[model samples]
Target: MNQWLLYGVLALLPLAALSGFLMGRKHRKGKQDNRLSSDYIKGLNYLLNEQPDKAVDTFIDLLKVDTDTVETHLALGNLFRKRGEVDRSIRLHQNLIARPQLSSRDRNSALFQLGLDYNAVGMYDRSEKLFKELLSDPVHKNESLVQLLNIHQLTRDWDDATKIAEELQSSLGVEQSKPIAHFYCELAAQKRQDGDIKAALSNVKKALTINPDSVRASLLQGDIHLQQKSYKQAIKSYQRILQQDIAFLPEALPNIAEAYSNIKDNSGYRSFLNKSLDAGAGVSVLVELSKIIQAEKDDRAAAELIGNFLKERPSLKGLQRLITLHIEHAQDSAKPSLQLLDDIVEKLISKKPRYACHNCGFETKAIYWQCPSCKEWSSVKPIKGIEGE
Candidate 1:
């Protein structure tokens, strides 16, 4: 819908309901019913003719403040807020709140809608007060708690968010474990940045307790272990990711290899990569495995492995790695042409994005546990295609 049209519809809603109410009250008296119906028809005619401004003016003049129209006014204000016309919605809702005749329930509802209007326009302080007020009202406790959770998330107040999430889970029966784990992960990240590794590890473990399959928690644990130079523990953490979610295999490979290298276990690293490849992992795993093969065995074996994998899962990264292997072993006659091909493949692979979000189709050159565009956890994974792996 056109934005203006949506606003116009919201503006006319209360007037339409008021007209109906007036018509119903006058039905027993049988007085001037035709006039009320005529006014409504004219307003609708203006809307149909695309004269939304005139329709809004007509509706505003026709609507009157009364109990019968309070719900209609609240509904209209909420519609405006949903359409992003926060100023108009706030005006309508605030007007409703000021009316002395409004019932306690209706008043609270208007306040809640006005709070949402403030939130929509980024007025967090004002929205926070209104939500806090609503939180005290038994009728709006659950909804208020949820909105407070959103506000806490926006402000990055993980502690407050965790508290409200727990309340929402218990009071409203809404599962919040996943989001709660994300909150702990955020706390862990903050602690890690502050050099409080012990506190960071504790928070990460709490995240895992909330969500055992949380890739973010595992990643953080591995990073902490790597920082402490606990190579075996880091290797264990990175390897756990594969069993938790195979889509994260690409993220674990480089870190896993580093941990193994630190422990001087080239043979163990090579075995791990081979196992990942045999499990039909993506081209990223295959490429890493091929590199290990080239380092340990020979260029020919690496090239052959890449060629066979490319037949099963064609990818630019795999092809680029294969070209590099061929270029290394090419004779004087074939060296220049192979080098040129290798350069072309390298350019192609470098230009392609390494990861993409399945939920939002957001592409990125680097891996992210949370999608940068959609802010969804574990959504961005290795991009697999002709120009990616």
Candidate 2:
């Protein structure tokens, strides 16, 4: 019922007719011509009867997959798949593959298309098996490996993904370090969830070795150390994010503060917060630095810091914190009004997404190392603007 499918069927009608004509010419036999003509007429009747599926089936059956007609069959099947007719595409490719006269190359092509058909419908196990069978294929080897990587990513089989990525890079000269690092980070996260800190650290180390600029790896490494109460080591790991990618400094600020707190080093925490603020960290850094100032000095001093910041870079988060500071120091009559303003800002910030995909514009409240919409590695980062870091 899709308009694209309708268009595709209409386009294929002529190709089917052309294929039949060409095959008839190639054969130059009266009986073969009569068979092709009869089948073509039958297909036209199905179309006239308003059964497009039947028409399509009949025409594709008439244009059998052979040297002369294989490309037409492939084009039709791929078009069906692109038009969201996966079932029809699968059937066409299956029929093409079943033909005994198809060349090895064409058969591989059909198999790959069939695998894609299965993948489109979320039948990943079947697609995985088909793609794996094509690993040694000359034409489809790299592509199959790429598909296999996708399947493993969907299945959360990080180990298999790592192997396939390594093979893709080593054999094909593909640059896969970024994804390879993320794969190790995934494995580390799984291990960390299972409470295997040693294995988690090992995987994080591998991730860092693969990509020293991996902010996710550094965050994971810092978390593992913090969990073990190795506060100094955790601080070291968390600070590494600044050198790796300063855009992620906001993510590390709170944890770094917690680490310094565990070691009872407020001065060092304040110094680190100031350094991060100087390095263009987000509003979170400013908020933490204000908290430190409020503890050491006074509410008015902290308010001044945030008020100065808001002048330079306006942020809802900064404004929210500034309102909180004003509420603390305001007269009782003004407190309710400031509190109401604070609640509005808080609610607005809560409704806004904290992270978004760089590859696609998919936004979410939580961070995803791989984008949920685009399924790209490390594409999701903290959103930047008034409502976010």
Candidate 3:
């Protein structure tokens, strides 16, 4: 297979680096040429025998770690790590780190590589300790902080993630507020699940203060207020999402309607849905608004609304809904055919994913604020197409 060929070539990278290293030293160290030549021949024989591990070992044994050869070792180790050969990468880096003659810069670089090797294999404690040691190294400080933040996130230590994010923002001028706000939202969600409404609200407020335009924060705040029977305040929080990002209006619509229902404000809910539709809300909003119309007037009025929208922008969901309304009032002979058509449209809509990640194109029927594939925050939105929204 092609993959086996690539692995074979990757296994020979250290041999190539060592050959280059020795040749660069040959002119100045003429007395050592005979031993170097013999060892090179032995390595080549090993490679020709398809014993790449023996070839690599022979090459490593010949190359001494020094100021001139440290970079070569680091590069080879990084290459191995990138190829998913973590054990080989870790061994190479450890070999380099074990040499006391290495300079401070070379040692720190090796440590960073080893930390990455550990991090790749989910050895977080080892990776965290190594990264912590490099926090004082000016060349690696910012990157080490970033890796530490990543570890904290994986471990679900939101408090630690927040601290690291703040440090990245203030010390390095890296834009971390978006992730930091998400961290607060994470903490708020935890507290809300634990039934500590007061603490949950406090964390949500902190998130909003950090990033006022966070749609997730607004949604979380609205949910928390709804749980506390603060229906009017919940409406305010849900309404803020429309102003922040109209694209996410669908996510808040069902909850907004629920909040209005709790307060006995059907008219207010209908008015809000109309405004959202005017602001270019998608098929979900249209569908919600159609429900209200059908309840208030008739199936014909609801079908008419979806028909008008589909005239300008086609949707499988809209067509399915429209077909269902017609089937409700059809003649007995026509009902079977209408029901069959509705069933076909319903299946088509059901098979399509409801959401997709903008960053990674990961599609799913359920919602995720952080994309599962790319690990990006707030990237997954409701999919917009004929079969979506």
Q: What are the models' TM-scores? A: 0.81, 0.91, 0.90
- Badly placed stretches (over 4 Å) of model 3 are 1-45
Say which candidate scores most in TM-score.
2
Sorted on lDDT, best first, the list reads: 2, 3, 1
Give the total clashing residue pairs for model 1: 0
- lDDT measured at residue 55 in model 1 versus the true structure, 0 to 100: 73
What is candidate 2's lDDT per residue for 1-389, written digit by digit as tens? 57766775576678567756876775785456667777788877776665778888877777756787888888888888998998999999999899898899999999999999999999999999999999879899989999999999889999999999999999799889999999999999999999888999999999999999999999999989998999999999999887887778887777887899899999999898888889888889999989889988999999999999989889999999999988977999999999999999999999999988989899999888888898888888887777777
CA shift of 318, model 1, Å: 0.7
The pairs that clash in candidate 1 are: none
Candidate models: Cα lDDT each:
0.81, 0.88, 0.87
Better of 1 and 3 by TM-score: 3
Q: What is the C-alpha RMSD of each candidate to the true structure, in Å?
A: 4.7, 2.6, 2.8
How many residue pairs in model 2 have overlapping backbones? 0
Worst 10 residues of 2 by lDDT: 23-32
Residues 277-326, candidate 1, lDDT per residue (tens digit)? Answer: 66656888888877777777888988898898789788877887887777
Writing each residue's lDDT as its tens digit, candidate 3 over 8-87 gives 95669656666856765764666466677787788877777677777876787677788877887888888778989899
Clashing pairs in 2: none
